[model samples]
Target: MGPGETGLNYMQQLNQIVYPGIGKTTNDNDCFVKSRSIFFNGTTDFEQSIEEEMHRYQLIWENGYFLKTLKEISHILNGENYDWELDIDSKTKNTRSNYIKDAIITKFSKAPNFQNLLKEAYNKDLRNAITHTQYNLIQGGVVLTNIKGDNHQPFYGITFEKWEEIYSKAWFLLRYIFSGLKDIMELFMFHLRKKQSQVESPFSYQMVKNGSKHMHTILKEGTGGLFINEIALTISYISIFEI
Candidate 1:
């Protein structure tokens, strides 16, 4: 559910329980609930400006919560202890053991079908540029100033089109992880209801090579269900009705 829908449901439940006889003021209560729910729904703009997209992307990247969440999800998928820590060198272990970028690189590099997706979605150069405030907006592109190759090039420029592509990949990756978490939770509940000691997922992850791009696809065991594909990412969920 979206934020607004979830909030509205909560308010309805709260009213039914907390104020069972508030029907005389139902209109007032509902109007307040609906109005406040819109705030949780956030902006209605479907097509945001480039600056706005960059601002949102920078916020997610800088906060780094998604990176940690992704790692935790990977741990769950691998049937590992959730608290398992990635091994680090002594220096890093003593200082910044869970550094976001380093942890992401280490964890996904070893993940079976996720290595290429990481490369596609997580651009170290773009990340450095955004985090360090070393990028500039140009006429039709962005110039990244925090990048240096073996040739020691001072700056790198990415066209607006390229920027959109990269941003889309990152956005889709975020959505995929979110969807996967919800799906996993539902699957866990199903497992408990079925009283199964162990359950094998009907879904499997596959890396499909599409010319120059690698697509990460989550496929179910059967056909005739819904499938949503977003660029290089695909996430599958079992409908509650089906469960």
Candidate 2:
């Protein structure tokens, strides 16, 4: 991760796919809900500005985590030379990393839906709109504008609904990759056991399957439901006070 890799070019290719609370406890599962609360509550001359700033910061942090995990997954897929005298002769060297090219997201773009989502959900153009301040909060949605064409004729505008759609799609794609990384880790542990001639493994494939399935359900469904629940809670609280 270089200092300026947060640039739009890098963000859309892989950085935009992030799972909000994938690793939190049940009692701590309020991050997305709380983030939505920012939209429901409060008003100030600087409120929109503040919200946008937070969005940028959060996106940056999310990419930081996303890229880091991707790298580790690359490592697992691309095993390293342990030079373990204990290791089997066939295990003297590893090549997945070489093939993966350091697990950069673009390397895996040959897959079917991947390139499409990367381009549509978190493309370079859209990232520039958010990162470069060429946007507006209009009608309760973020409006992204591009004025690049001659006479600014072929300009582009991305509305808030589209952004939300991108967010949802990005969530599923990113989490699917993360699930792969987790599965790889479990496989690593199993390999270590087999290398030791141990017939039993500490890993549970069923547990991993269940976890992965639950993640799919949540990212695909829970994102919106959490916001709706939060909005309702906020409304109920307000109504109680008013009544």
Candidate 3:
């Protein structure tokens, strides 16, 4: 198949695997559970997807194996074998992960501020209030509560409505990162296409261009003054490419 056809096919597969209608349960409780599942599953799954795509595209771009190279470099820097799978976890406070950290350090360790900047940004306060809130997992779903202090006083609790807000933020974050990565991938592919006239690249030059353009368009359009818009933008920029 041609580049465009292959690109569309890959996009379809991506939508199926990553964009499963995870939060579409009709029941309110099921909705919350599904929402949480996306985050938890995402934390465990998205990195590998990104890495696999990156490597696939890199080979297409004639850049060799980017993920493998990064892994080797990370291993060298850390003086130990590096596992990309280890980085995938929802509870990981450090967003960049040790593997990513070692890779960055390996590449730009001598650079003036890359390490410091990365270190600072890696531990960002992506900590949503929902993550901070306490929750009890029942058979059906989870009940969210705002427990405060050592005394564990229940502050403002979350039922369906409040939980929806949190769920929306989580979903927004996930989409933001996904779209942002698409943008970066598109840009990479665009450059690669120019460098190598081959259309076999999985990077999809046009898709990344379109993705970045769309992200900018959405930001320009604005979200009608929702606080979540800020979070969406922040996560999009931060997660896909280093801010």
Candidate 4:
């Protein structure tokens, strides 16, 4: 299937996974959950739908795997393997790279075409407007009031059509990264299974899936359980120990 189709399928499957308090607020006594919060829905209101779409795009742009994948790819390209995070700048060393734009322009300069894709996907001005709450909803689109043009003069915001284009590019980049990582993970798992077959081990892993796998803190325990709270899934495991 095409990438779009594959992405759609993946999203559909992801949406199907049931979580407690999903589409609802979790409190002692009150909550409401709606899938529309996560995805743009069949709302009749055009402006509202556009607003929701913009918010969704902004959310992903800030917290998505796209940036993380970029850092990991940069590390591999630089041929430095460490258990720790990367220090892109030694002068002011940080685990995270502060020079994200440099990562695209300078680090990945060898691949001009891919660089273009990254550049197209990332719009610092637009993100700034969204992040800093410097925009307003117009008849057809929101105006980034602070964003200026080549002459360094403030211009009107992008059209709804333009915003849609930007959002699509960003979404495509996300799916592309996800697909690549999935392949790598599958290959790694295959190798892991192969290695396991060649070893005789006393250790046995027991996975108990109560629901969707989430990492919860195993605070008061001899054994540890990883809870992936972001996905709201619960998977508990017991490791066989010779006790």
Candidate number with greatest TM-score: 4
- Model 4: per-residue Cα lDDT over 85-195, one tens digit each: 323234123422235576533565545666677777777777767777788765455678776666655665776557767877766666555555566556655754554
Native-vs-model 2 lDDT? 0.40
**Could you give the candidate ranking by lDDT, starting with the highest?**
1, 4, 2, 3
Query: Global lDDT for candidate 1?
Result: 0.48
lDDT of each residue in 1-243, candidate 1, tens digit only: 122332343344333322332112223524432432332222433112555566545544443335545555455444453432323223234433245456554565446456566566667677667767788665446788776545765668887667767777666666555566567666655644453233333343554343333333333323434232322111222221121
Q: Tell how far residue 180 is off in model 2, in angstroms.
A: 2.8
The TM-scores, one per candidate, come to 0.49, 0.42, 0.29, 0.53
Model 4 scores a TM of 0.53
lDDT of each: 0.48, 0.40, 0.36, 0.47
Query: Candidate 3, clashing residue pairs?
Result: 186-208
Report the error of model 2 at residue 101, Å.
Answer: 15
Model 2 Cα RMSD, 1 decimal: 18.8
What's the residue-level lDDT of 109 in candidate 2? 42
lDDT winner among the candidates? 1
In model 3, where do residues sit more than 4 Å from their true spots? 1-17, 25-156, 197-243
> lDDT per residue, candidate 2, 186-215, as tens digits?
665464444434322222222133233211
Error of 1 at 150 (Å): 10
The per-residue C-alpha lDDT of model 4 at residue 126 equals 77
- Scanning candidate 3 in windows of ten residues, the lowest lDDT window is 213-222
